[model samples]
Structures are given as C-alpha cells and as structure tokens.
Target: MSATFNFTFDDIPNLERKVAIVTGGNSGLGEVIARELARKGCKVYIASRSHSRAEAAIARIREDIGTDENLAFLELDLETMKGAVMAAKFFMKLETRLDILVANAGLGGIKSELTPEGYERNFGVKHLGHFAFVSTLLPLIQQTADGNVDSDVRIVIMSSKSYENSHPIDFDNVRTTYHSWFAFLTLREMLQRYSRSKLANLYFMRELADLVKDRKNIYVNACHPGLVYTHIFDLSTSPLPWYMQLVGQLEAKLLGINVNDGVKTALFLAADRRVVDKNIKGILMYPGPTDGFVYFSNIYIRTINKLGLDDEARKQLWRFSEAALEKA
Candidate 1:
C-alpha cells in the first residue's frame, strides 16, 4: 500500500453553499463528520432516528462552532426501505440540491436479530436501507451534477475492513435469522454476518458507480474507518469465547483510534479535492496510521475472490435490492 499525503480536519475546505446529509449523525463518527461539515460553512442535516439525540448533538455542535445556522435535523430511520425513502423525499422537498450523501449509519457487533422488516439487522440498515435512501435521492444528486459541470456530487457508503472476513453473501440468509442457531454457537457467526453487510455496502458502491459512470460530476465511494472504538461492540461481546470476551470487553471500552481520526477517511471522500482530481470512485477505502488512505492494489478488484464483489454478485445485489424496494 503506497502511503500518500496525510489528512486532518483542517484539510477539509470551505463549503459556503454546499448541502450535506450524514445518516446516524447523532453520535460517534457520524456526529463528528456532520459537525465538521457544518463548521466548514456547509448546510448540514444530521439524519437520525432519534430527534432528541439529534437535537443534543446539534446543540453540542452549535457550542463548538459558535453558530447554529448551518445545522439542522432530518428524521431518518435506516431499518426499513420505507423510512429511508420517506427521509430522502423529505430532504428533497426541503432542498433543491444535494452535494453530499453519507450513508454512514450502520449496525455493529449485533446478534442474529432481524429488522422490523424481517431482514437481518446488519444487512437491513447498513445495506438495504442505504440502498433505498440513495436510490430515492439519486435523481436529485444527478440533477445537482447536471445543473453544473463543476458540481462534485458525492455518495459515501461506509463499509469496513472487516469486509475481508465476510462469508459469501447468501441472499436467502438476509431476510431472516437463518443463522440464528449458528449465531448463538459462536462469535464468528456474528462477525461474519456483520462483515457480510459491509461487503454488501461495497457491492452497492460498486454498482452505483457503474450506474453513474458517465455522469462526470457524480462520485460514489465506500470506506472503513479502520479499528475505531464505538459503543456497538458491547452488544455482541457476550457471545464470544470467554477469553476473547475479556479482550473484547476491554477493547470495546478502550481500543481503536480516536473518533476524530476515524472520521478522516470519510471526510476525505466527502470534501477532499484529491478525490475529484484522481476520479476516486467505486472503491473501498481504508485508513492508514495517520491520514488519507493506504493505496491497495485491489482498489477496483471487485471480483468474487476474497475482498470485493464480482459483477454477477453486484448485479444480484442490485436486483434483489430493487425488488425489495418495490415490495416495500
């Protein structure tokens, strides 16, 4: 992996008239990303399921930036296609253009519980929900791009390095807890399913870029924050072997990079000029020690092998997603 220039929050440029939406922006890395975008003079909508939490985050951001004009909350629930669609429509009614859409909401370290929509929780929110959200919003995104040749419309999907650990995604297993028994048997099952969802995120980015390839102003990307500590780890730690559980408990409480560092790659994908300069679209970006990304050889290697998606897999994912959205 070739190491390039490092990045920090200061690297994000001014966004005086830009508009951005970050899902799960009420807390964790999402909150940080939303806050930074707001600070840089962008109109930011923190799309979240909890209005109260989003309000609190907004207040904190206001305190940090000494301004509230750029921050607002949009209701969003990523567990169902209906909610995702409704949220996108709502945003569209509120704003004519969208500069950035960060599909950053996700489930982490969860057991084999299904969503209210009867899909696996990880896959439902992380993949299917964002799929619906982006699909509904694509027209507006494309419109913004078409409205200006210089417009840099960005769609950032948050995948994970754990994608390398995923089992081959079995479409049959996504709609229910077909792995519930196995999930109860070992921690690997939980991680496997979660990683499977991240892989699904990658596949979504893969196909979306292809869908918009001719649209020079639009960029679609998926990325992982590397090993960053987030509270979701507590949920699945109990299922681990006792020794690994001990380590996981400690790590969950005190491990990984700081939340500030974790947000860099996403921010880079969102606001960095290098992305547009290099045409960095449809790639899985992972963090390096300090900043920017580690340039891996398989950046576009979406073959069915270990790390990314095959064309058939990407097609199947899109087809299933389109069918599911229609069903919803």
Candidate 2:
C-alpha cells in the first residue's frame, strides 16, 4: 500500500541472452524465480544441493516452457567453502559471464547440528556458504557488469521478515567454545537464535550494497518473500505440535501465496527498470500483498526504512561481514 513503488511487470523487457544463477532453484521461491527467468529468455542455472530435485525441476520446467537451451542445473552445497568454490569454478568454465546471482538457498534453524564442514547448520548454509559463493564468483559478476555497460549485474539475497526478531551476526561468537550449545537452549532461545541468523541475512545484503556502490552496472540487494508455503517447516525439530502444523496448513490454504508469487518481488527488483536507478543501488525490498488484477506491489518504503538500514549501521555491518568472509 506504499505509494513509493508501483506493482507492474510490464517494465521488464525481454532478457534473451542474459545468464543467471539461482541457488535453491529446484523448489520453493527459487523454483519460481528460475522458471520466470527461463520464460523470459534468460539462460538460468538451477543450482541445487539435490540432484533428484534438480532433475525433477528441469523436467517440469521443460514441460511447462519447452527445453530451453537456456536452462541447466549444477550441484552446489552451500554448507562448505569447497562446494562454493567448485561450483563457481565450474560455472566460470561453462559460461563467459554471469548477469545475475540469486543467493536463495538457505536453511531455517535446525535445533540438532552442524553441516559436514562443522559449522552451525543454519549459519553455515544460510550465510557463510553463500558468502563464499559470492566471493568466488565476484570475478564473473564483475565481468558481466563491465561487459554489459548498460545493465548492472544483479545479486539478490533471499532474506526474511523474521530478521526483526534476530540479533546481529556475532563475529566474536561465530565459532563457539561449547559443542553442546544446542542442548542448553529452551524453545524460545532456539527461536531467537534462528532470528539472529535471519538478521545476518539482512545485514549481509545491506553491507554488500554499500561495498559495491561505486562499481558501475552492479546492484546488490536483499528481500523478504513474505510468508509462502515451503518445506521449511519440515525441518523443524521434533515435529511441531499438531496444532501448529495445522495452523501452517490453514495459512497456506488461505493466506499464503504460491512460491511464484512469493518470488515476484525479487524478480521485479532483479529485472525491473523502473526501480533500477542509482538510488536503488542497494535496496532492501519487501514483496507486499497483491491487489486483485495486479500480480505484485513494492512495499519497501513503508517497511524497510523503519528497520534501521541507516548508513552507519550498514557500513559497520559491511566491514564486519567483509572481515568474516576474509577469514573464511
């Protein structure tokens, strides 16, 4: 309902030769973003952790829009730096450039454990993994930006509204001293930790935008997809109470939008020209409710400014994140 943004897709022109990589593109919001890109003539790499899911996604996409020489898949596990580097190297050989990088693959807080790399599961996959992915792939993204001359290389991080409840990335505490930190927390504490991770996602986006501001034809941003029906709940610890699950089901049935719709905000910011001005060089967007007859709305002004994405905080977080990535 904010007057700052318009809800229309007509602003995006054909994306024919453009190449994009969408992590977690096999399911949920990522799937919808990849499909839309393919539909619009983008060569999309549906990078996923599961080969089976990737295969099925490719099959479905092929059926819906025909085999696009533009669509392909790559195995990427964001849980480790090696996987991120390998995927980046593989892509560098596969294509001459990368026009868009959607860091959408993420895991909600798992009360149980760590990834194969021994980092906290949510923090590892959600931030550190994606952090390494971008660092390794920056050359390609930079090249694409330089080559295009007219369009910026878009990097959209998939963040969440749950960020409000979380704390900033504790650079000091990333590597904990205690192995059993998981067992000591109550349910509410676990939720707070999860929220803290989500906050990191937002901070990462904000910091990235500032870091890349001087570069021409390169825009970095983050967004919240609102509430969508995804398998995130399936990963909850010890199976949520039946009533809670039932509530989620009811929300999906009545309140939740399809992943495709959920992803439209990212798509808009990633490709839309109206909001692509220099002012949007580092935007934090929120996808608002769609009114009848319109597929999307931009809720950035009403939502983000109040969230303390001020210049000072953004710069501090950027420095912190840069340090974290450098050490990793």
Candidate 3:
C-alpha cells in the first residue's frame, strides 16, 4: 500500500496541559507510547495490573523523559470486568479531564482458558476489559472535548493486523470449548482467539466513533502496530512447537520492527493535529515503515467487509459487551 501521510513524534505539538492514560503502559509498545507522551510534556498515567511493574515503568519513563511530575501509575487488571470499572472510577476521581486514552494492553499465544467473567482469556482482557474501561470513561472524554476548543480529545485502541484473520465473532462460542492438547494445537487456538479479540477491537472502535460522532471534538481510531519484537510471547511459560519457536525467533530477528517504530501510528492518532483538522474518526490506520505514513487502504476495507462487520454487528457486540459486564 502507498503511504498517505508522513507523521512522527516530531509532529506532535506541545502537550503540557494534556492528561493521558495508557493501559498496559508498564512494558512494550504501551511503555513506548507513554514515554513519548511524557516527553511531549503530557501528564501520563500508566495503568496496568502490577503495582511494582507499573512503578518501575513510571520511574524509568520519568528518568528517560527527564520529568517525574506528570508520570504516575494506576493499578488495572483487565482480566476482570470489575477491575476495569474500578480503574475508570479511580481515574475519574483523580483527573478532571482525559486528553488521551490508549487501550494498549493485550495478551496472546496461550492455552485455552476462561476468565472469572466466563469469557475467553484473550477476548476478556484485550477486548472486553478495554471496552468496559472506555465505556466508563467516555463521559469524561466527552467533557474534555467540550472544554477544549484548541485540541481534540482522542481514544486509541491498539489493534493488530492479525484482525484480518478473524472469523465473524460467534457470540455463543466466544468461550471456546477447551481440550488439553499438544503445543502446536494449543498455539493455534491461542492465535485464533487473539485474532477474534482484535477483530472485536475494530468493531468496538467503529461503533464508538459512530456513537460519539456528534461531539465534533472527540476523535476515536484504531491502529495495527506491525510486527515488533516484544515479550508478549513467552515460550517457557506456554510451550510451542519446536518449528514454530524457530520461526518466531527468525521473524523477530529479521522482520520485526522495533517497539519505537511500532508505536508511530498510535502516537499519530493520539496527538497529530491533522486527525482533528481532517476530523478523522472510526478509521483503521496502518503506518508504513518506509515513509512513516499512516493511511487507510482498500485492502483493510475489503477485509472488514469480508469479515461481515456492519453497523448491526457493531451494535450487537456493544450490547453483548455491556450485558457481559453487568453479569461479571
């Protein structure tokens, strides 16, 4: 695909007054995004599951960015819907407005399991947790938009290009039937579940953008961070086929982009003035490595269409998410 717009952290304007939250900010792409925002003078709250990890990330980010005042940690565990709700409440209690909300935390490549909320582990944490968190904080995001005339209030969901592989979500089978099996079969199931959750992220982003379209000042978008080397895969923790492990190592060594490069599209959607100027919303962004341009292409459009994603599907997912949260 051709590059459409060239963007980088250099294009991010001063964010001294902005307040942002990045889920899973303790490591990987989330940490990269948080550090960049902190560097740009934004107050960044690193929300994740572990207190120690989040604290360490905050400390490291503060040291790296040379400012400690705006970096803080808020405990969040997305495996449970209640944890997401509590995180939202905690943020609302502490911050008056939210300038950026990045749903960047996710997990993949694991054995089949169900969360306490009775959803597939991958779908529960990566999609539903963020869904609940965003639903609770959306009012504050809208309020931020209402008060800020000079900047756009943004929500960025970190989806993956693997979303292209997802089948249309089968709500009834979201908690997939489990069977103990060999490493390769388990790995395949894990990836399939992860793909489904990423697809859910896209559906949620599209529906959310539509829901908030009338606000005029709030912008919502999702992005696919091209393959990058990170610790999300732990072969020691979850066994993988020997050949699959070899392939993963080769891909990481040769083809994977650095985490810094992986985060460009998310940073663009969060802080780029063009997003607000062009009123870009509900679109999926893909950042090209060659020119650092973020664009929407026909292939992505065709993929979404082939996946059978429509307004009705989006709305159904929303309802299912809300009902699931209530039950949880």
In candidate 1 the C-alpha lDDT for residue 144 amounts to: 91
Candidate 2, residues 1-328: lDDT per residue as tens digits? 2335654545566888999999999987888788888888889999998999988888888888787577898889887866887888898999998988899987653554666756666666787778778878988888888877686678998887677766555654554422333333444445555666666677677777766778867888787777776776554453245565566556655676666667866887678765565346565677665421133445453256444465665566556656655655
lDDT of each: 0.81, 0.71, 0.81
In model 1, state the lDDT of residue 58.
97
Give one digit per residue, the lDDT tens place, for model 1 in 93-186. 9999999989999866555677888898888989999999999999999999999878899999988877878877898888766343343455
TM-score of each: 0.90, 0.85, 0.92
lDDT (0-100) at residue 33 of candidate 2?
85
lDDT at position 326, candidate 2: 61
lDDT-sorted candidate list, best first = 3, 1, 2
State the number of backbone clashes in model 2.
4
Which candidate number would show the highest TM-score if scored against the true structure? 3
Error of 2 at 298 (Å): 4.9
Model 3, residue 199: displacement in angstroms?
0.1
